[model samples]
Every structure is written in C-alpha cells, then in structure tokens.
Target: MPQLQAAVKELQEKGIALPDYPDEPGTDAERDARARYDKVKGSAVNPVLREGNSDRRAPASVKNYARNHPQLMGAWTPESKTTVATMGAHDFRSRQKSVVLPADDVLTIKHVAADGTGTVLKDGLKVLQGEVVDGTFMSAAALEAFLAEQVARAKAEDVLFSVHLKATMMKVSDPIIFGHVVRAFFADVYTAYGEQLLAAGLDGTNGIAAVLAGLDGLEDGAAIKAAFDQALADGPRLAMVNSDKGITNLHVPSDVIVDASMPAMIRTSGHIVGTRR
Candidate 1:
C-alpha cells in the first residue's frame, strides 16, 4: 500500500497524464507510454540502495546468470585486488626513480669571423679589435674571469673595449665540475696571451697608440713603426694589425727587426689561435 501510495504521489508531482480505466482500447503508442511511466514510478517507490548489501545482489545475479549460461563466463575471471595493488606499487616506484634522476646541461660557443675568414679569435684579441664573440659558458666564474681579464688587458693597452655578461641557471648532474673545467681552460689561455704581450715592447702607452693608429687605416708597417719609435725612444717600435675578424696580426718592420723578434710582436704575429677544452 505504501509503495502504491508513493508511486501515486510521485506521479501527481511529476504531472504525468493518466488515462481513465473505462476509456476505449488505447492505441499502441498510448499503451507503450503508459507502460514506461508505470515502470519508472514503480522503481522510484523502492529505489535500489547501491551502497549496501542490495548493491551486491546485481553482481550475484549476474554470476548466477553466467552459471546458467556458461558461454558468458568463457575465458573470464574476476580481477584479483592484490595483483592490481602490486602493479600500482611498481608503477609508483618507477615514477619515483624517474623523478630522482638528474638532468643534463649543454653549453656551446658560436663565433663568427669578422673578416669572413672562417676563423674566430679568442676574447682578448676580439675585444682589442672591437669584434663580437657569441657563446654560452657552463661556468659563470670562468666566463667572468675571462671577460675581466680581457677588459683589463684592453685598458692597459689603451684600447677601447666593451662587454656584456648574461647569466642563467640550467639543470645538470655535475655542474661544479663542468664549471671548473671551463674556468681552467680560459685561465690558461689568458696566462699564455699575457706572457706573449709582456715579451713584446708594445705593452706600453706608445705601443698601444701605434697599434690603434695602424688599425685606423695606416697599413704601412714601416711608417707606423717609425712613428712609434719616434714617440717612444726608450722602447723599440712594433707595428700591430687587428684584422676586421678580431685576430691581432703583428709585423716587425725590417728596420726594427733585431736578431730576434720581440715577444709581443710574435704573439700577435700570425693567425689567431683557436683551441677548445
């Protein structure tokens, strides 16, 4: 009685139209609609509880149906909860290892020859000649030291130079070692160049001025050498040329050539040296 009452109450609330019992035989469409409405209302009165024992009834019914119809259970078994848990744990551990593994950082240097000579000189020469050096460094300290050395040398030589340093952090497994190697390489190059420059008499004011003038359009080595010699009688005159590509090429005039070439002169003398670490 309660179920019937609830269904009747639900039908009234939903505003479903119901036919009188004395009506003439209903058409097929009318009968179908009435059947659907009755079925829904009937279920609503005693709604199945999916979260309780009532929920288990559906699967049990399905199992019984499969038993009665064995073909439906062919090659089918309920999945084991333990196997699923083990697989989930394995997947979790794999993801953890992936998270713990370190990443790789790559640093590269790109140099373009100013003279289109397919050769790019190192930092010191490039700065003195006012050329471009584009590259990435793994070690910030190494890059900083290299730039500072170049700037200092240019200032000492009375040559105009400028620099811009950009820093960024990248993930790497061994960033410290990578940085140390980079620093060591540049330091060696700087030391080598410094030794070369000291040997040349061109380390002083007069030498730098002569070099600058030579770079400004004075191509005749003898003329520039004479001018430098006259300006600084104390030290011998040295003619230096910095190619548009930033390579410092030094030439000792025949007149100034002693038994041996000056150290500074030899350093800047040939093609720029390009070496990698």
Candidate 2:
C-alpha cells in the first residue's frame, strides 16, 4: 500500500493524476470509485506512467503479418463498391444534457479528503454527464434490425455482410454492443436462457460465454445448448475471427475493432457496414 501511495504521489507530481484511492468507500459513488481503483491499481498505472499515453502503435510483427498474409487482410479492392456504416463514436450517450459548473465550484471524484472535503480534481471544468443507454439505443433489437437489412441486401447482391465494433478504448459501451451482436447471432440461446441469465446476473452485454458460464446447475442447460447449436446452424453468414475455433466476431470484444475491421471491408469490397467506433 505504501508503494502504491508513493507511485500515485509521483504520478501526481508529474501531472498524471490517478483516481483517488478511497480509505473507506461509504456511498454508492464511493463504492463504485473504489471498484474502479481496484481494477486499475496494479495494471493500468504503469502504462500511463511509462508512456504518458495509452494508445500504442502496432508492433513490427503485426505490420509484417499484414504484408505477408494479405488474405488475412480481407478482400479489399479499390473499385466499384458502396457500403452502409454504423459509427458508435458518440451514439450511445443517454439522457444527453450539459452541465456548466461555476468557476468557484470544482469537480472532484467521489472520494473525500480526511477533512470530509471533496478535493478539486479538476478546476475550470465543464462536463456533460450521462448514463450509457442500454437496449433502446443499442441492443439486440438494434443489431437484429440492422443485420436483417444488411443480410437481405448482401444476399440479393451476393456479397459478404460485415460488421465493425470498437471494444478497445470505448471500453464499457462497446462491450454492450458486442453483447448485442452475440444475442443477435444466437437469438435462440438468449431467448431460452434469458430469465436464468438475468437471475444469474449475466446479460448479453457480457457476451454469450458469460451466459453459458452461469448455467451451472440449471435443468435446461442441455436444452439451451441444443438451441444454441441450432441457432448457429441457421443464423446469417457471420464474419469469422477464427474458422478453426469457430470464433465469430461476436465471440470476443476486441475481435472486430472498427479501425481494423471497417477498412478491411472497404478495401476488399463492401455490403452494409455498421459500427459505433
């Protein structure tokens, strides 16, 4: 704990502020702050401290692979193609409202100082705080409607239907979109195990593996498994991450990164591209 404190202090000296580590998290906000602190405690700080930034350029090997294994790059051609794209950049913001704080008022994280004062984490600040909207804005229903249209268009023109998502930096919201993709792809699995899933505190936003992982001792596990199998058999043609392991784009969060995935489609050719990058 002393080492962590010293490191955080050093970062603060360098103007690389880390979230305040709560001594005792009391309220819901404090508890959430503590949970976030726990996650970044050992893992996240070093990256920022050492590099001063999170975004890293691609490794040499990755560039080599892109050159050597061109087919892995997707069927990108420079001519005769049009595509529909979904950009997630700022689409998932819910209850969009702006708040302008007076200059005398400061915005601090939820943690309070020993004197019970909220320290000024940021001064002269402006914030537009909003909850991430689930379902209505971006959910399985949304993915289905999109895929239904794209799949129809792709089949009509005999082209590949592809999707783009960014589960990298957008972190929280993109994972939810990824979950929607999973539920849309495996509609039956979700329909069958939904109640059990919600009861187990699992949702499509966490991915289908989470739902399956929570099926510990359920009576309908086998039935859900069968339905999942059938959904795979009948679902629309999905972009594959790994054909050998059957890793579809929706199987993992970072598989279909928008920056990487969308360009690949545009280069190869395009049908209807959708993303919230």
Candidate 3:
C-alpha cells in the first residue's frame, strides 16, 4: 500500500493529473479511484497482531468450588461413536513449506498449473530478516472426497453431521471451503439444479441461509426448496445450531467456529443438537 502511494506521488510530481487519495472521497471519480485503491490495501501486521497461543487455567477459587461440588460427567464407553473428520492427506497441514529468512527481501507468490500456465497471486510482499514464511495449499479434490466420506460415515453411524470451521479468521479460504461442504452435502441438489441456482445468483459460499433467501425470487423456488427438504430428510441428521428454529450447523459459514464448537461438543458428550432422527 505504501509503495502504491509512493508511486502515485511520483506521478503527481511529474505534473501528471491525479486526484489526491483521501480517507473519505468527495467526488464520484475520487470514490471510484478510492474503491480501486482499497482493493490493493492490506496489512502486513496480520501475523504480528495475532495473540500467541497461551495456557489458560481456572482461578484458584473456581477450582476449589469445582472440587468441593463436582459436576457429574457422562460415562464413556467403548461403544461411543464420537469422532472428528479431517483431510488426512493433501491438506494444508500435509503440504506446508516454511523458511526462515536470513535477510530482508521482497517476494511474490504465484501459482503454476499442471498445463504450465502461471498466475501471480501476490507481488512485492516485503519481509524482514529472521521472519518465518510458510506456504501451503489444500487439494480441492482431496477435500471433496474427505467431506463426502464423512457425510456417508455420518449416515452409516446414525450420527449428526457437522463441519466446524473458523471462517471469521480464515476470511478468504474458509468461505470457499464451506461452499465445498455445502455442495458436497447437497451433491444431488447441485447436480440437479446447479445451473438454476447460479442463474438465481445464489452461491453456496454464503451458506444455506443465503441460498434459501434467494430462492424466493426464483420461478421454481418452491420446487428447489422441496429438493433441499428432501436432501435433509434423506441424508444423515444434521447438527443443529437451533433445533426449534431449524438452524443447522450448515446454515452459516461463520456460526460454528471450531474453537467454540469443539469445546461445546466435548461438554455435551460428543453431541451437537440434531433434528429428530
């Protein structure tokens, strides 16, 4: 962002007519220019600003009270069906590459296709000495397969299916991933009416709530909604965010964050609320 501003200033000094960048634009053209500039604006402080992992412990008084009046927990048994699903291979964890920079330098991130086509994802990202840079990508095909398997396993085991993701933090990636989950779970619905959904401007990336809301505008909205209802009925029970209101874990990408959901699931004996089986 600083480099872009500097370049703009250099052009202005050469007598080139350019509108001054402002925090708030006063004109239509300036507003348009501001929109364009904002797209390129990003913070390098994201990594540095995040708090590091730390150990959290209960207060001494709380610990003493808990010990004095212990809360009963459900008994664990060999037959317990609790489990977590993950992309065991071809995921970000499996493919991560990292380096400790010995000297300060600028870098570019790019992607090269199997057919030899190249594209730059980011350019002129500057870094300092001793900084650790890591890069990784999850295989989309592997992810789809993993989600499909989990869906099937959920049905076979008669357990509620849910996918917990931290979409708020992983702003760019997790929404796309959540879309994949939506499509996987409703593979039949997508296969049948994918074109219609697209034409209606309903994207799964925004989650089922958005999709359902957009349906009201479609000519065949009722029919499409019926398909969704059938999908829920035929598939395994879904983990509900609110059973009474019919909000499932799949209702929104941001609702069930992994950190929040994981602890809640643990406290509930490996169960999240589910619709009647």
Best by TM-score: 3
- Which residue pairs does candidate 1 place in steric collision? 199-264, 200-264
> What is candidate 3's lDDT per residue for 1-277, written digit by digit as tens?
3334555677889999765566888889889988875565433234332225232567899999989997666566678898998887899889999998888789999999999999999998877677788999999999999999999999999988999998877778899999999988998998889999977767688899999999988888999999999999999889888788888888999999998898777776776745454
- Cα TM-score per model: 0.13, 0.54, 0.77
Candidate 2's C-alpha runs over 4 A off are: 1-38, 41-82, 87-90, 93-162, 271-277
lDDT of 2 by residue, 1-277 (tens): 3334555677889999655667798888788888987665444434543454755788899999978887643455576445665634334444244444333232443446569987654454322223221232334455567655665664466444455766666576677766665665665666767787666666666665666666666778778767777775565555666666666566667777788766666564553243211
User: Higher TM-score: candidate 1 or 2?
Assistant: 2
Note each model's CA RMSD in angstroms: 36.5, 10.9, 6.0
> Against the true structure, candidate 2 has what lDDT?
0.59
What is the C-alpha lDDT profile of model 1 across 26-67, one tens digit per residue?
787767766765544332323332223343345778899878
Instruction: Put the candidates in TM-score order, highest first.
Output: 3, 2, 1
lDDT value for candidate 1? 0.34
Misplaced by over 4 Å in model 3 are 1-47, 50-72, 199-201, 274-277
At residue 247, what lDDT does model 2 achieve? 61
